[model samples]
Target: MLRIHFSSGDLARTRIAEEPDPLWETVLSLQQLREKSREPVLDGWRRRRCARGGRALRTLSPLMPSRGYFPDFLTPAEGSGGLESGIDAVLSTPRRQLCGELELLADHNPLPSEVRRLAEGETGALRRLGRALRDYHASVLEPGWRDIASRIEGDRRHRTETQCRLGTEEMLRSFAPLMGWQSPVLCADYPVERDVHLQGRGLLLVPSYFCRRTPVALLDETLWPVLVYPARPLCSDTPAAPSARLAPLLGHTRAAVLQALQTPRTTSELARCTGVSVSSASEHATVLRRAGLVASTRQRHHVRHTLTQLGDHLLTGVQLGRIPPPSASRHHGRA
Candidate 1:
């Protein structure tokens, strides 16, 4: 079991990541690709990845093994910002840290020539790794990114509501079967035996679409404290595409706007995602808002639209899972 010890100040400082961490997802997805363990859910996604990832695999496979410790530097804190910044952070890892982590990896798996060069801080090897990260994300991850983001968003929203309705402590407790929250100490079943003490720095709760079995933490706890847990929501990784059930009723463009609003988007962003004019996107959001399906809030010059409860129901028409009370004991459920 991995135990995380927290202090009162740690509880006060604890918070959730604002967005998905791209590099973290990239690393976890690579693990999923190799294990092919999630069965029907990830089967199709795995197949697609296998077909397109040969070039990227040549560079990334040796660095990230099917199991055991992968380099913490591969998933930098900057990853929450986006892919470019994340890649930049990875490439900029201190040479000393790079060499040390690679040495650890080599203890278990033989490093390829490219990976060896990377450990040596060779510029060419670092450049190739960057290209592989980008190519892999573009080909393997980008396709399911929208659905992935939506799932994580749903999990975050559930946690946020729990925090507000009960309290932060209660929200923490809600993790339940996935994590045992017993006040100052949180516990979970882990692949390796380890303990993480918050030591007053607090913790960052990161929900991941690809993370499975057990939550993950940085191998190096000295970095900002993060607890990455699985956010399996709504559908499987490769759920068959939903038939256009809502499109005809709402009209194609309006329906597109509704779907794009799944994770919140500005009018311009909505326009881009739905391939509609800016004015059209704005108009649709207004219509959806008036219809009690979307909520829009102004942030400076941009208005962001998000699905309201009714809107969410209209879009999904499915019950989202809820974090059970600490007594539940069972891990995941759609309560």
Candidate 2:
């Protein structure tokens, strides 16, 4: 169990990361590759990654063992700047901290020869590691970045709605069944028992598309505390073709409304994009909302409409051509 102690100040400052942190995604994805368990969502990705495997696999394997510590420098706290920026951060890690973190890894498992050289601050090793990281991203993550970004954006929309409707405490409580939120403490299911004192630095809650089962947190307490948890699955196991299923049934206008809602948008904005009147767009949104495929919440003056989980699943199935026509058993429900 990992018990996170949150002072009142910490709670006030806690916020969700606005975008996916690429370095964290790389680290977690490496861990995913090391494990033999297969998830349906990763099937296509795994196949494509394995097919293109080469220096990325060979070079990164040593740094990420099947189990045990991976140097913290590999995933810097300043990763929001994107992949190249993150690689630069790794290359520029302070020598003492780099050696200390590497020593921690060495304590639990034998360091790969190249990694050992890296720990010694060898310039050549740093360049090679940077290359490996860049290659890994280009081969593994870049191809599907659009889908990944859409999914993350959808998740942020849902979370923002939750915060607007129920406040921060309830939003925190919604993270996962394994995570418990009590006054001043957020307890998480973890492999080992540990306590993290926030000390008013607060916590950054980052939602990840690849993270599975238990949430992840930084091992070193001195760094900015971050808790990475699994976001909702972006789509169903099978991909469906959208034009075939959705366009015919919903018509172009309604179909456009559903498609535009992968991210939140107000009716007027939806109207502008779909070239329909505001009233027409609102009617379409109303129908979608009544069908439980769209959710609309009034935020002060503007009402933002976002796709519900069912909406996303339906759209994904439609786009991929996997969803079947409505049946007695296929009732739409709230996300």
Candidate 3:
């Protein structure tokens, strides 16, 4: 069970208590904000942009919150009008938690490569935004899970197709003017290319609504909850999230092998620490490399093995015990 409270302003003083069953407070506190816009002129431009491509307004959709939670577009206040009155509720909550939940719920999501295209060289922005949404879910949402169940009943729940698209279009339109003026000089020639990347990447454009500075939110939309990050922030830099995926190996043997490999190592050294035969050690390395967990680089006559991102994740998981051991899963098999 988790508990959370929200307020219109002064978050710390708002009595917005949030608690998750496992106490994922660290994951829930980072917070996410977005660029809000109020320019109808920009909206008209975005409509033209949408028309240029076969992509309709229907293509721009909002990422919904998890199924069990209340639809963000709805409010606790009974008889509130649709959307307009519920705007704050729809936008509230940290962005990181939303992104994480969406990833957990959906089958496919954007990775670094997709993100780079959307960000236009703003990797740091994407990361911070993703993390912020995840944190919001963990910290601000209500504890009673069932409270949201009835509201989300079956097909017509939470985010309707139209509502979702409208929200997304509104955000994109807000950025149109800026995209025309502030974007790279070459961007004008390649408008469609830029548009595809930005919209595909979940970039939000807000007018001068939040501030006079440039406004946008690079968000993670795949996550069910949807994560967001502010475009032009007041802070020097936003907080970062701990890696979501873990390293691929576990146990003392794997740890020892990794530590010894400041430079890549031979199977013999791996076997010595692992207390296995050279043949057995070589087999383990082979499996790791095949899984993209380790890399092999040639050094003289010997082929040395070094851990890759997945391999490092295995090691981290072993240390943290947050993820299950590699051996426990059939995918890893016996090595």
Instruction: Using TM-score, give the best candidate's number.
Output: 1
> For model 1, what is the error of residue 18's alpha carbon versus the real structure, in angstroms, after optimal superposition?
1.2
RMSD of each: 18.3, 13.7, 22.4
Which model, 1 or 3, shows the larger TM-score? 1
Q: Write the per-residue lDDT of candidate 3 for residues 1-335, one digit (tens) a residue.
A: 01111122212121101111111111111111212233332333334443322221111112322112212212112112322223333234345543444444344433344333322424454444344333333223223223222222211221234235554222222222122121111011211222222222222111111123222122232322121112222122322111211223244334444543433567654554334456866876776677777898777876778877666665454452344456644676324
Give each model a TM-score: 0.68, 0.67, 0.20
Candidate order by lDDT, highest to lowest?
1, 2, 3
Write one digit per residue (lDDT tens) for candidate 1, span 105-163.
98988887878889889999999999999988887778778877888897888888888
The residue ranges of model 2 lying beyond 4 angstroms of the native Cα positions read 37-52, 235-335
lDDT of each: 0.80, 0.76, 0.32
Q: TM-score-based ranking, best first?
A: 1, 2, 3
lDDT of 1: 0.80
Per-residue lDDT of model 2, residues 142-242, tens digit only: 77677666677767777767877887776675553335565567766577888999999988888887777778888989999989887765455434335
| Model 2 residue 144 distance off true place after TM-score fit, in angstroms | 1.6
Q: What is the lDDT of residue 285 in candidate 3?
A: 78
